[model samples]
Target chain A: MFLSFCDGNGSALGWAVLITVVLGVAGCAKNYVVLLPNDDGTTGKVAVAGREGVTLLEKGREGAAIGGPAGKTFMVSDEQIAEDFGAALAASPQKPVSYLLYFKAGTDVLTPESQADLPEILAEIQRRPAPDISVIGHTDTMGDAAENARLGLVRARSTAETISQLGGSIISPDRISIESHGEKNLRVSTPDNTDEPRNRRVEVTVR
Target chain B: MLAMRLLVLAGAFSLVVNVSSAEDAVIGYVKTVDGDAVVLVAGKATQAEPGTPLQRGNVLKTGKPGSMGVTLKDNTVMSLGPDTELVVDEYLYSPSDGDLKLGASMRRGSLNYISGVIAKLKPEGVSLKTPAGNIGIRGTHFLVTVEAKD
Candidate 1:
């Protein structure tokens, strides 16, 4: 049975050993985690800290048993993943999309290009079910911190207002949250009193 | 004298209310649901639907055939499968102040998690606690399943 588990891969022997050990201790309910690839096809790492030690999972579909010793990992079959996470996977919502709408210097007015992109932002919100939006405004570092904060809020409020007006019945006023990051969060890093166009913008995220 | 005392008591009560309201700002919202999903707030269960607000310390649960999806303010996405019970133990997402944390505990069932700005900015701050062990997120996607203990 252990030999049958090996698929002639370089790591087959190690996997067979792990599978044998896993089967030997199958009394308790199985608890585990699987590393999956991101939507963009990039893989990241997860560190599972068990009672014994930590196990780092770096490959897609790679899994490790919870509450067990570290260094014990095996590839989770697609069927097993389907059976275990089918509902959670199915319940996954559409990924949120973000838009950076640049503003005119020291003003709440949107740049011409950003104004043209408003419709696309509206379409993204309308595409989702029960969509909610967050408009976070930022300002360049050319003014006083407190004043920039107020300016950021003004920009955010204006953008949110425009979005609500364009969305009309599709968007509820309560679902839109507006905040200001001010000079504290600049898109382009610059010294104090330096003007940067990219830093003066409103970020809209539709979820 | 009694009226003055009552007025002072009311003043104190309003202060407490304001503090709590500011502290418990909405951290996320339910974006999708199928069948019987509920969010437990202040020990009371409310049927969850799209646009339902989520606060820290709330419990998200699903029935035998239920499932739910939520998106946090930082764009972190999470979905729960049937018979799942997840608690948002802590959440702090003030990027300007350099405060970013996301922590949750899963008692049972499955969860699909996608990293967001919190994990991207401070990977050490994101964690998912399970009955058996804890998982540290590092700006990626993963799935976890914790079977009920016998």
Candidate 2:
């Protein structure tokens, strides 16, 4: 009887531990759904949220700073799951990087140096895992804001066209927004000397 | 007695005005596509169940799946893609009364939009929200797709 009692207790303890180990293995190996309280993309693994899946973005509006959604994760519902996935997949928000390239004078064409730098901008775009880009043009205190915006747009478009035709990697024109600040963001803010050569170039940024 | 009569008159007038001012609902789903103006809420077949009341669209389906060729009352065209979900959260018409507003949220997939009157009211009036961020628009046409970010 004494031996039997001891054996029974040992068996019970071993079974409990064995069950725990099995569960641990399953939890660690398989991606499963663990219901979360919030709507953010916490819908567990393989579960898709339907209702709260979409996120809206307006012009000048920044969305949630979502890092890459790698590894197993969870979401609350199908909708939230979708939204989180969309965000995870969306391109990084790139703040336009402005560079003032000074031309010799009032010329629509880009000089050799400026042309060379174009490759650098294209290279930057290629660097990101998936980079978003935009180009805003600027001019010296030489033309009207409306005309400058138009000219700047044209310049930006021409440069973008060249990049597209490079045939290395195709960048969609729609993805690139080209506009002119019309010297609003000047490279140099000399009170008397508003017109600077540095202000006549294009700015490129990748996110 | 005279004062009570005047109060009742004012109350009646207020009630009548309130009844007149209730806003109506205008909502629809993509019915079919016909080039520019996509159909919304298929009037298909012999259902003859009238149709979904039209509302000032915050988002419309056009030349896209789910809601292929849906048009808004404002004449704005929304082109949506397969497996994509869009919601017109809030929309208002009549600028003088108040600015006509349009708001949309995308759950998945891709979409394209062409603005009409509401956008005309405010140049930067349209807003598209994705998980990554919000897209602010002012007087231009654009398209967007949802993809995994690295």
Among these predicted structures, which one has the highest lDDT? 1
Q: Model 2: runs farther than 4 Å from truth?
A: A1-102, A111-113, A126-133, A143-147, A167-169, A172-176, A190-193, B1-150
What DockQ does each listed candidate score? 0.79, 0.04
| Residue-by-residue lDDT tens digits, candidate 2, B1-150 | 999999999999999886545324443323233222222233322211112233433333322223233344444545454444456665665442445776776655555455555776664566656664455545333444553222
Residue-level lDDT of model 2, residues A23-108, one tens digit each, is: 54221211111222212322111111223352222222122111212221222234533433323212112222334344544555
Candidate 1 fraction of reference contacts recovered: 0.92
Report the C-alpha lDDT of model 1 over A1-207, residue by residue, as the tens digit.
332342223556677567768886343245888899998899999999866789999999988777656766778778978888999999998888999999999999999999999999999998998888999999999989999999999999999999989989889998999999989987889999998999999999999
TM-score of each: 0.88, 0.34
Specify the highest-DockQ model's number.
Answer: 1
Write the residue-wise lDDT of candidate 1 on B67-129 in tens digits.
999999999999999999999888989888899999999999999999899999999999999
lDDT to native, each model = 0.89, 0.46
